[model samples]
Target chain A: QQQVKQSPQSLIVQKGGISIINCAYENTAFDYFPWYQQFPGKGPALLIAIRPDVSEKKEGRFTISFNKSAKQFSLHIMDSQPGDSATYFCAAVDTGFQKLVFGTGTRLLVSP
Target chain B: DTAVSQTPKYLVTQMGNDKSIKCEQNLGHDTMYWYKQDSKKFLKIMFSYNNKELIINETVPNRFSPKSPDKAHLNLHINSLELGDSAVYFCASSLRGESEAFFGQGTRLTVV
Candidate 1:
């Protein structure tokens, strides 16, 4: 129940197109969901996040669509660029447990 | 200034050797974490320290140990390293247990 499953282990999108990555969690105790972006040889960095209270959150070109009922969430990158090519990971945090569980990363390649 | 910094970006050692990875955060965050990313890019939490206190241990092997000298520093020491221990280790810090975390450039460990 602690797992956060992510889909499309690899994705290829053209520049100026939309890039989407999906994730689903089984634990309802998770109150916070965050997406992280990691470049080669670099650590994962926070890209955007959302809480269960809201259905969606958007930050500039990055957006997080969440569904509490389905226990699912997704990250959408608008106007995808080659610079956006990297590994994206979805994570859920259970405050009571005081730990964040991560999903298997999705390697996104935004082609030029 | 780097928010989170870890030493020895790359480590190559034999299976029977031991190694240590040092991590420090200038962010003054109360929570810190150690995460391991395998060859398949699967990220898993190894340990967590809050206020310099051990808070989370994810059933990792006894050979793996974490030490937090202070809130600003957390370190991982591996004894009797095995080939399976080869992975990219990341250090991260957060304001608290359920907040956005900042990660350092990972340390890639290769146990041959």
Candidate 2:
């Protein structure tokens, strides 16, 4: 079963706009949530991560807003640029487990 | 220097062939993982190792095997490969369970 579910498999955003992708997990035990970005022909790289304890985390133009109660998290890219176009994946893991359950990815295309 | 690296960015082979993808991390992390991404960009974990010991093995096929020579390296061997095995394989490393993971550029394997 897919523990994590992401919506809007594809997204389009204009440069300087805000691009948001949302994810939800069914496993309540999941405590760590992370977002990764992958360009074509490249590996997924960790973009930003957040824990359930905090409601949100901001890293420059990227931010992760996590809602512990809803078991949902969203990544927002502010001032999106063409370079920000990439495939984004969200993953959740239990505290003591080495494996992570990833959501169906979102392909974001930012056009100038 | 690249933190995590994989050999042979592209692998093209025929069915029933046996192949291996090697991964090494210079970050001195104790945990490594192998992930597969499919046509629709669904990222899934296949295996994980910690300190050269198997820790997590998902419901992947028996044809897939993982070997870890040390904490810095984890290699995946796929035997009797089928057309379904054609996908992008990624290698990742983390400090431990539920921590941030660093990924290597994927290996695109096309099975004809």
Pick the lDDT winner.
1
TM-score for each of the candidates: 0.97, 0.96
Worst lDDT run of 10 residues, candidate 2 chain B, spans B94-103
How big is the positional error of residue B22 in model 2, measured in Å on the Cα after superposition? Answer: 0.8
TM-score of chain B of 2: 0.97
Poorly placed runs, candidate 2 (over 4 Å): none
Q: Give model 2's DockQ, 2 decimals.
A: 0.78
Give candidate 2's error at residue B89 in angstroms. Answer: 0.7
Error of 1 at B87 (Å): 0.5
> In candidate 1, which residue pairs clash?
none
- True lDDT of residue A67, candidate 1: 96
Docking class of 2: medium
Cα deviation in Å at residue B64, candidate 2?
0.8
Q: What's the true lDDT of residue A102 in model 1? A: 93
What lDDT tens digits, residue by residue, belong to model 2 across residues A1-111? 348999779999999999999999888878789898989988888899998999999999999999988889999999999999999999897758766788899999999
